[model samples]
Target chain A: MRLFISFILCVISIAKVQADSFVVDKVYHPYVLPNEQEFEWRLFSRQTDEGNKLAQHIAYGFALSERVMFEAYILGERNENDSDDYGLKSYEAEVRWMLTEQGELWADWGALFELEKQHDSNDWEATAALLFEKEIGKTSLTMNFFMVYEWGDNSRESMKNEFRLQYRYRFLPQLQPAIELYTGHNYLGIGPAFMGIQRFDRQKQLKWEMGFIVGFNGNNKDNALRVAIEYEF
Target chain B: MFKWKVNITSCLLLFSCAVFAQRPEFVLEIKDHLFYPAEIHIPKNKKVKLVIYNYDATPEEFDSFDLNREKVIFPHRKSIIFIGPLPEGRYSFFGEYHPNTAKGVVIVDDTTTVNQPLEESSHVD
Candidate 1:
């Protein structure tokens, strides 16, 4: 009986730290397609005074209806402790619902719900975000406010909040330059981002984005580099 | 001097006529994130107005890279958009939020029939 009780305690303790261990995937857009499918891959790397972290993610996305879209992502990560060892980290799913059309009001709006399950640990997290977009001529801005709650046998009982912002200048149909900012508890980052799209035909297209952020506040990394590529058919 | 006066008057009248002419209009409806009449036919070489009504409780973005136009239609609301005196061809559009299901096309051709759904003609007699 004592051995079983100790085993239970161990499991609960592992679950707690796992809930808060995942990396943040911060780039987002306010548009949703009515009937489209996509396969996307993203690479995120961070360098701090303490250590370096790298994460890889693959996702499949499809429109559920005219205003709703769904996506699933498989994530892997490598940290200083793991060195070159990178393996399955977590599985995440999300639903995005567009709330307003572009130019229909002062700003466009959308909402997102996400759930993440960590591998080999009894840990999970749920997140919700409100997304906003606005455009004036060649300039556009987007913002996302996120609320995350983690739960499990050992998870913290507090809610975590985050905010991300991006501003872009459309220089051409396929290329744009942007600035991004992120803020969270004890975390602040600002960076320059560049993105472009290539349409191969009426039905196929490719998009790429790259960003470099410098941490500006406490307990945050000094810099991080993020990149994402998506293919739609 | 008499010929010049006649020419000036004709030009003024033509300008007024063009200014007063109204473009044809069509109604597109969105429900459950799908565009009604997935295919639309309109007269070629004429500007037209599109009145889109969204019946869903969520917003969707109407995007058409081919037409170089995009608009967000709020749920339970209506939006108006204008398209050009385009050449005969097919212009495809989709909901950016629900791209997989909200797909459609606008077919502009000279042979578009009068019986098709279109706004009242604004041609000057």
Candidate 2:
């Protein structure tokens, strides 16, 4: 565990050296492992008429119970038009709770709680999210509703709500094509996403997701791409 | 402090009660990344306990998007999951760690006489 922590720290420091635009992480399911550890890395790039931005996030997580998972993330971002240097922007702690067992209700549900602190400023943000997932035949739908509160220096203190929707077709066990939509106060994005899982052995597996988004309105970023890789052990 | 203690005590009692509740048990075995008895039939609208034993040296994640259930079974270990009182239908599951071969289903039947054979009486034939 100590070695894993060190690795996470090292990756985060390296990722901060360069990055800019921001993209929201997408969810495909709402299941948490029981008594296992997971490591995840996500890279996102956003392109607009003005400039391009890139960001990197590294997280270390563990399943505390069958229904609960806890994680910490290091976030870094940089803009293409700005200096070529990127530094750590913030730190985040998150907890995910699986609210109901699969097939136990009309719809499977979960929730997420997160707290983030910015590095250069005293700004802190708290987010609460509801996660819903349902499977019908070969298709699965997942949605997230998020409410955030930011405070302190340059803090908006006001609540900001966001919604994300994903519809995926399970074409194969290793490949699933998806469509994603993200909507917020002044931003709207629609994109194509793909997810897959590869089993290396009985004890370990690699899961990945990648997507590209095009902003629909003038206030939104013109283009964005997000990629995430997760390793479970 | 008094309120906190009472809350904790209540939680413990509830947990113990749940643990002691008796439910019909079924076993699913994982060998070579394949599930034996790939289809399980249980009466509809009744909760049941499923005990999964992974005989393989490697761990496997039992995933059923249709069932909304997922659990990681460690090598040579057993895990128990309770699923319930569901409508009549077929719920499919697979081992996430070995999706190619580990697949199974849960069939909830509403018919009570489904598992029992009817007795036929012959008089003069």
Candidate 3:
């Protein structure tokens, strides 16, 4: 446990050295059940020196097979300062692949791929990510390493990377408390998150999550709030 | 780019086919929201298929924290899940919708014979 904590601190230190773009989003897990289907909505709001920003996503996803799932999302954003700028921002398609059976390996493994296009412009972005999860007793640790490439007429072609980590303690079937960390080019944030699920008959369940994050970059007063709800059937 | 896409697609198809190939099969039945047999014995360290038939008018989700498996069996329908290749131990599972009455355990042991049918118990407490 000491070694694990040291490793986490080392990673966080490295991440903070060059961190920049703050991303407030839900952490993805590495499990995919066969024939599972879900509809999800996510809201993220951030307050920074520039202004306040809000983004929303609605997505529908289904498993293609035991190990693979596909999802599509409609994304919208509003600049609180610019009242008229609220509208659709982008469309995204994502694929998640479960690489290892849940306890078959020392740690579970998965991957994610995403392609996004701007609603009214030629801007596009593509991302590939590796997902890892390890369970120690009732606590679970998950991490994501992402590589992104952006290109198009409206944006400069560039490549970027991001890392996210979540450590969760499972106290009950319906509730779990977690600590999450996210790092990117110009931002580093850590926060507390809570998630729960309510199961219903006929293969239906509702899952909800919320988190509040504060930026750690020097002289930057940034805060973000994110929430998500998912219904699976 | 096109060639890369083709290669990835082909690899995924091959992997999917390999995963769906032959494996040891077992059946569990859910009636009146209770799991039949109450306990099942299987060989340890081997992947196996579990086909659950739900006879209740309402659906039930087979949930297990120990085995890390969760699946919903629809009313009057069957659902399939693959479990194990795990170490020898007792893994408990319960019906999410009827947690009070629908419960069972999977006993993974080397000495125990696999798939020995047991009389279905009428009640679980």
Candidate 4:
């Protein structure tokens, strides 16, 4: 009886964590519109061992082509943390374009183009990557590999690439069990990210989503959890 | 006089671009327990964007089995819906909140370019 109860509890926890990100086997950029270029506003707050911190992501997304969507975000103050409070933090923006959609009997695939500011240093510094996603049954997976280059300073001319992979299992409606792996040019490690989304009564116009992440590397560690709410405005 | 002509030509070009750049549009309004217009005729293989106006102040979701898209139009607010260049077919849709009240079809046919579903016989005029 005890073992059965423990198993049930574990399953519930995993299911809740998966709700924030896995639905279509795609590495859904933390901030992008899949179809329509509507103006979307999102506010995120998370708690780490350091303190309670909040950040806002204001973005606009619209389809550039029949199959392509472009989105840009300017991350406002990520203050509240010991490290962030010391100096001014630069705003970050990411633009992702979905290329194509593919699927098989039990598997599906999607391709995307993602550009993000690198090193969190300057807006000019950008990285471009090809993101691929595939899934089998309730298990969804994603792999994103990107190459970075300095805008004005191409002295090194060397391309720094990074890869991120996530696996999620959907057990309940709007809930899943998730595990995310990330490794890149300047940093390396793995973490857990969660996704949860719920629709309002009668209409799905109002959707609420939240995400949790805990990451650790060989060097310094970052174990943070994020919660965000959006009203499809 | 030559400069005025140049200015006039530029204005015309800009206007053309603006008109052509916008997506194809449709409007679906709920009235008398049914979708006004009953059907939407759109250009085949093109983007069919729609504005769903639920004037009744009741929440509703536009759902289409053939169009492969869905959107919830809140009470009294207009919801923008975008559908794609699907092959010629009759796509049926309905209101999830009030399925009995709102229902319609989106016919994607290149040969039938009429924006209103006034029947094939009527188009003969």
The digit string of per-residue lDDT tens for model 3 on A102-126 reads: 6546688999999999999999999
- Comparing to the true complex, what docking class would candidate 1 get? incorrect
Each prediction's Cα lDDT score?
Answer: 0.75, 0.76, 0.83, 0.53
Which DockQ value does candidate 1 get? 0.04
Whichever of 1 and 2 has more DockQ, that candidate is 2
CAPRI class of candidate 2: acceptable
How big is the positional error of residue A128 in model 4, measured in Å on the Cα after superposition? 2.4
Ranking by lDDT: 3, 2, 1, 4
User: What local lDDT does model 3 show for residue B21?
Assistant: 59
Pick by lDDT: 2 or 4, better one: 2
Top candidate (TM-score): 3
How do the residues A60-176 of candidate 1 rate in per-residue lDDT, one tens digit apiece? 999898679899999998886567678898899999998865444557799999998988788888999889876654567887877789887666666776667788887755888
Top-down DockQ ranking: 2, 3, 4, 1
Q: TM-score of candidate 2's chain B against its reference?
A: 0.71
Per-candidate TM equals 0.64, 0.70, 0.74, 0.47
Instruction: Evaluate every candidate with DockQ and list the scores.
Output: 0.04, 0.23, 0.15, 0.09
In terms of lDDT, the best-performing candidate is 3
Worst lDDT 10-window in candidate 2 chain A: A14-23
> In candidate 3, which residue ranges exceed 4 Å CA deviation?
A1-20, B1-36, B40-61, B65-68, B71-92, B95-102, B106-125
Please give, for residues A63-171, the per-residue lDDT of candidate 2 as tens digits. 8887899999999988775866688989999999989876545568999999999989999988898898876656778888777777888876666666677889977
Give the lowest summed-lDDT range of ten residues in model 3 chain A: A14-23
Clashing pairs in 2: A19-A54, A19-A78, A20-A54, A20-A78, A21-A53, A21-A54, A102-B67, A102-B68
- lDDT string for model 3 (B8-118, tens) is 999999999976654666779999889997998778877777778888888788898677677766677777667777688898999977988999999988844545333
